[model samples]
Target: MSAAPKHDVFQAVADPTRRQLLSLLAESDELTVSALSAPFAMSRTAVSKHLRVLSEAGLVRERKAGRETRYRLEAEPLQELRRWLDYYERFWTNRLSVLRQLVESDDADEDVLEPRGPRAVD
Candidate 1:
């Protein structure tokens, strides 16, 4: 099976603002839109738009909190990315194991070789 997905989680997270929002949400359980946008030098509307895309991707949830709406991180969708990556992780592990074996074999060969003067190369 192909390892990584052709899906667009990377695209969704491409924006610096969106990444910041995700980081903030990860640090806190839930926050109001105002709270989420507090660190950014942007308008409420702009932040809301980013939040909307995140919501559509199942990465965030918005719910009415008294008069203000709060955004909560829905991290379960990250599992899709992880599952897609699992195959590649296994492949890399196998490749690294082979590299380690090769390196160890090289060391063993070096130990068995008698000391010799450097060879001249053209």
Candidate 2:
């Protein structure tokens, strides 16, 4: 059987350029390729390539306006990423809480076992 296409939200956002593109799109309703390329040192073509990756990941939507092709952020796909990260966030929070309790208990035990009086000379 043929393998399914491998494009995914994680892979799409993995590149710094693509992440910047997403950030730019998020800040505005839509932006043209030229507008998106303004703040970057890369060429417009490079910016478009990043946009294409976002498009494949369903993290961006494109629309034609007159002579310009405008791109907009599509945030629905990010819900999956957020949910996945939130699960790990809770997991780490629980682990840290347990660790804190253990450390506090150990400190209390150490205090109880420590000698309070000065030692006598032999």
Give the candidate number with the greatest lDDT. Answer: 2
Off by over 4 Å in 1: 1-10, 106-122
lDDT of 1 by residue, 1-122 (tens): 84543335666577889878989999998998899889989999999999887777778888997899999998888787788789899999999998688667845676445558887789
At residue 4, candidate 2 shows an lDDT of 44
Give me the overall lDDT of model 2: 0.89
For all predicted structures, in order, the TM-scores are 0.70, 0.82
lDDT of 2 by residue, 1-122 (tens): 95542568989878998998999999999999999999999999988888988998889999999999999999999998899899999999999998688667845677555678998889
Top candidate (TM-score)? 2
What is the overall TM-score of model 2 with all chains considered together? 0.82
lDDT of each structure?
Answer: 0.82, 0.89
